[model samples]
Target chain A: MNALLEISGLTKRFGGLTALSDVSFGASEGAITGLIGPNGAGKTTCFNLITGTLPATSGTIRFRGQDIGGLSPHKVVEHGLARTFQAATTFPAATVRENILRGALLRHPLGLGAMVFGGAAARDAERKARQTVDEVMEALDLTEHAHREAGTLAYGHQKRLGVAIGLATRPGLLLLDEPAAGLNPDEVDRFATMLKEIRTRFGLSVLIVEHHMRLIMRICDHIVVLDHGEKIAEGAPEAVRDDPKVIEAYLGADHAK
Target chain B: MSMSATSSAPAFQPMTVVWIAGIVLAALIPWFTGSVFHFHIAIMVCISAMATGGLAVIAWVGQLSLAHAAFAGIGAYTSVLLVTRLDVPVLLGLPAGALVAGAVAFIIGAPLLRLRGVYFVLITFALNELFRLIMLDIPEFSGGSSGIAGIPKISLFGVTLSNYQSVYPFALFCLALVMGLLVLIRRGQLGRRFAAVEENLALAESSGIPTAKTQTIAFTIGSAIAGFSGAFLAHYVGFISPETFGFQLSVSYVIMLVTGGRLALWGPLVGALFLTPLPEFLRGAVEYQHVIYGVVLIAVLRFLPRGLAGLPRQLSRKGGRG
Candidate 1:
């Protein structure tokens, strides 16, 4: 399958320290790719680079065969590549519905004149946006809590809201940084099911960075392992999991047992 | 849970009904007052309300700007120049001032909006100083420190608005227009984006909101409104001066906005109404007038962090619990 997102020779350096060194990876279209690594492995940094929140030191990031290496975050989103941070970042002061509407508005922007005049075009855009918001809320099971402030949501629901925000972008490629990070075991299982359901429904590619091995292993079609900013293994989940380097990277050399 | 979501109040309410009654009373003020002094104070309040309205709009987008009065100055100078030098009518020239101010704001804001928080505030403060210096240095056009005098009275369709009676209605109309524009903006999608950007920039950007553009839009609109107010000030007083629009004026506008409530729709209106005539009311305590003003402001801010607009909510909550 053709890759929806392709990161090649991606490197990020912080003065003297190199955070991501010549990392290369690809997530195929409509596939759930898991990027798993220990702490200080540059997983979040890589996500930031691809999402255009952080500048890359070197290399190219191709989304749908177009080089989008240096676009601004919003422009990157405009190109149909969206991401959620490791921490669930929602507009705390806004309600869940409003937060989702913000994302929906990206698809159909209301210009300043339209905003002031409120004619048929603006009304149509708003109606479409509200519909999109409703659909997204229902898909993420956030309908009941739609009117509540996003900051007041439970930890698990906040994570779901983060995913819902990304979904509202209607992205061709969704980058989720630890969507299952603070989720409980049952919630993690449910999240994996949700990811699969979303994939089947939307037919969009997902690149997830998660420390939850059970969730990642269960849901990911392919797995990539990174250690100290370098790619260590990449293949089918079983192949990468059984790789000696992956075992050594996680357990350390002495604990190869 | 530090975030305080705005109350989900329905579109129409008892408060709006009260606002309409207040407007009616304001319109009838000229009939009751024979003295020009009373009309002058009322006009001052209207202009201050419009200027503070602009400040409130910028604050809505999560920025505090000290250059608002400078924008007013731009409007005053531009409109005055167009009317005196180029023979443009007051109606065309007034809006022209706002447009010029908005244009300058858009240009400056594009680059400056990138600076967040205190740095943004500092840059805008510098901008206010820059505008003041430009006005003082360009005496050839701005009339220097003494300022331009004998600004012609507004003549609309052969009805010369020369007296307090004539000017009061126009001033009231302008204030109404500013208030209406602000209310419309607050109730729109654009306003949602502004709040979202203020609440969380990273999240707002990831949600594909062009945060920079939103900031710029807010700043530009605020500047235009201030310019609109300033243009009215020029015509009402029949004079224009560098001293008229300065950092102190901007600070006063800020006080109005802060005292009114940062997030509430009517915050600035309450602030302008209360504070504009405060000095006149404090004439008996002239020696300690500013001191009294200081104390009152501090007390209000310390007790009512949401400004005077939040008073009703606070009172209701207190009553409910008590």
Candidate 2:
């Protein structure tokens, strides 16, 4: 399968600590890719680098043949790459529908003059945005909470709203950071189903950073394991699970024996 | 399944009618009493409201600008110079002031906005002081400490608005234009972008909204409005100096905005309406004027944190609970 997102030799360093180093992976078009590791294994840092939240120390992140390593976050989004945060980041005061509408409008931003004058183009864009918002909310099962302030929604609903926001941007690649971090087992299962449905429905690729082994193993077509800021194993879910390097990384050196 | 989809249609609310009626009554006050003082007060209210309305725009993007009055000063001087030096029409000078102020804001906003929260406010405060000092240095164009006096009155289509009564109507017309522009912006896509940027910068950027550009746009538009208001004030009051658009003036605009509603579309206007005539009403207790303002501000911040424009909503919410 063709790579929707391709990263190679990616590295990120703080003042004295290397958060991610020489890490490389590809999320294939229309496939669910998983990035898993122990805590502080640099999974989130990898997402940050790909999404342009932080500049790569040294690397190339090519999305659809365009280099997007150091682009601003919004510029990255303009290239059809969007992301959801680990903590369900949202415009807390805005309603869920409004939050999604904000993302939807990004696909069809009216000129400032057109926006103020209420032209036909502006009206058309507004209609399209409303439709996208409605569809995203329905897909995420958040239609019932559409009018509630995003911050006021239940934890699981807020997480779903985060994905809905990412989906509304019409991205070719969606990066989810710790999406199942706090979800209960049942909720995680529901989320797993929703992820698969959206993959087919939206025709988009997903790169999910997760700690839940079951969800990753069940849904991901490919799994890449990282340990101490380096890729330790890469393969199909079962093969990666059986890899001794990944086992040592997850369960420590003694457990691998 | 689409809850409140039809809520987009304009719904008749009793509070909306009440607000309109109250504004109409206030607009007719000078005419009813035939008081020149009342007309003067009304005109000042219009100017204050218009300037504060500009500050409200900057506030919407989640930045507090202490240099707002400096932008107004930039506008005031630009208009005064154009009218006096080149024989430009006062009508043309107004928009010229706005253009220059907006241009200045566009130039400075990118660097200035890099600083957030109190740092942004502090830098703007220094900029305001810098503006006053720079103008003071150029006494020839700025008229220095004593300032320019006996400026031309506002004239539209060769008819001068020579008295407070005539200027009051013109001021009202200008205020209406500014307020109309605010409404148009608030109801549009740009408004949503502004709200998103204000609410969460990181989320807005990640969602494909250009947060920096959105903030600069708000700053430019807001400063332009301030410029126009400053020009109008220069012509109406017939005197201006660096002192006129000083820190005190900027603080007053901030007070009006915070007291009115930082986020409400009508906050600036409501704030100006409630605060402008307050000093006049406290004529006998002149020494206590600022103290009263302090008390009112504290009361509003505590009780109606959304400011005066949010009063109806607050009252209704309380009533709902009962």
Candidate 3:
């Protein structure tokens, strides 16, 4: 499969400390790619760099054959990329449907005129936004909480809502930051199945930062491991699982048993 | 999911009736009162409310602008210059002022909007002071300390508005137009986008929303409305002065919005209506009026955080259980 998003020689530095150093990876089109590591392994930092929330000290990020390095976060998303936060952050005062609708409305390019006027073009845009919200909420199993304030949602549902919000943006590549971090075992299993189903159904490329090893291993077609801001190992999930570098960096020496 | 609630249209309700009645009463104030001072107060409320409404828009986008009255001053000067120096008609002058103010706001907002929270507020306050000083310092164009006098009365489509009563309807029309636009904005998609940006900038940006542009749009619109109100006030008073739109006036406008409730659509209107005629009612204790105003503002902010518009809802909720 061709790569939808390409990152090469990526590095980020904060003063004397380098958060990421020469990390390289690509999320292939229509596949699930996982970035796995222990705490402070630069998983979240990598996500931030790819999403344009943090400036890269040096390197290139290409999305759909266009250089997107140094672009603003919103501009990055406008280029067919969307992301969820490590924590389930949302528009706290807005309803669940409204939160998704805000993302969906970004598809309308005419700005305020298209949003306010009831012209044929504006009406069509509004209809699409409503439809996208409905579909995303239903797909995320959040339709039952559509009208509830986003801040009032149960914990797991907030994570789902975060993913649903990213989905509503209709991105070619979806970046999920620790999506299964706080999910229960059963919920993690369901989330893994859902992620796979979403990849196949939406034909989307997904780059996920996760600590949940079971979910990552069960669903990811390809895996890249990071340790101390460096890529320790990478390959198909099974190959990476047995790699001595990844075992030392992540699974520990006892992982062989 | 309750899809039914999403699909249902808003019903014709008591609030609609109340809104219409309020507008009608505002329009008839001059005719029923038959007093010029009453007309003057009514006109002042209309102007103040328009300014307050503009400030509320800025607040909606998560920025508190003290430069609101500066925009009004810009409008006043633009309109006055067009009429006095260029001899343009008042009808065109009014809109020209709004256009210029909006343009200036858009230019300033592009850079200043990068600063968030208290830093934004401090910069805006400095800008307001700068606007006043510029007006005071420039005598030839801005009329200086003595101010511009003997300004011509406004003529709208052939009829000249010569007195307070004559200008009452026009002011009422301006207020209604400004307030109506604000109401439309609140009900439309713009409101949702503004709320999202206000709630979380990072989340909104990640969702593909251009947050800076949204803030700039709010600032421009709010400034434009304030400018339009200023233009109307200048013509009605038949004078223009630096003191007419000063830092104190900006503070009052902010107070009006906050007292009425910053978030609600009717808050500024309720604030302007309540506060504009208050000094006159407190004629017996004119010395303590400012102190009283401060106390009342503090009390409302502390106790009724939602403002007067929210009072009905709060009351209903309290009475519901009983």
Using lDDT, give the best candidate's number: 2
lDDT of 3 by residue, B203-278 (tens): 9999988889899999999999989988888888889898888887788888888888888788889889888878
- On DockQ, the leading prediction is 2
Off by over 4 Å in 2: A253-257, B1-14, B284-289
Find the 10 residues in a row with the least total lDDT in model 2 chain B.
Answer: B1-10
Which candidate should be chosen as best, given TM-score against the real structure? 2
lDDT of 2 by residue, A1-257 (tens): 58989899999999889999898889999999999999899999898888888988998999998999899999999999999999978899998988998999889978889877778999889788889888888888988787788888889888899899999999999999989989999999999999999899999899999999999999999999988899999999999999988887777854656
Q: TM-score of each model's B chain?
A: 0.93, 0.96, 0.93
**lDDT score for residue A65 of model 1:** 92
Proportion of native contacts kept per candidate: 0.74, 0.81, 0.77
Docking class of 1: medium
**Tens-place lDDT digits, model 2, residues B71-91:** 999999999999999999999
Root-mean-square deviation per candidate: 3.5, 2.1, 2.9
- The clash count of every prediction, one per candidate, is 0, 0, 0
Error of 2 at A19 (Å): 1.6
Give all TM-scores, in the order shown.
Answer: 0.93, 0.96, 0.93
Candidate 1 chain B, run of 10 with poorest lDDT: B1-10
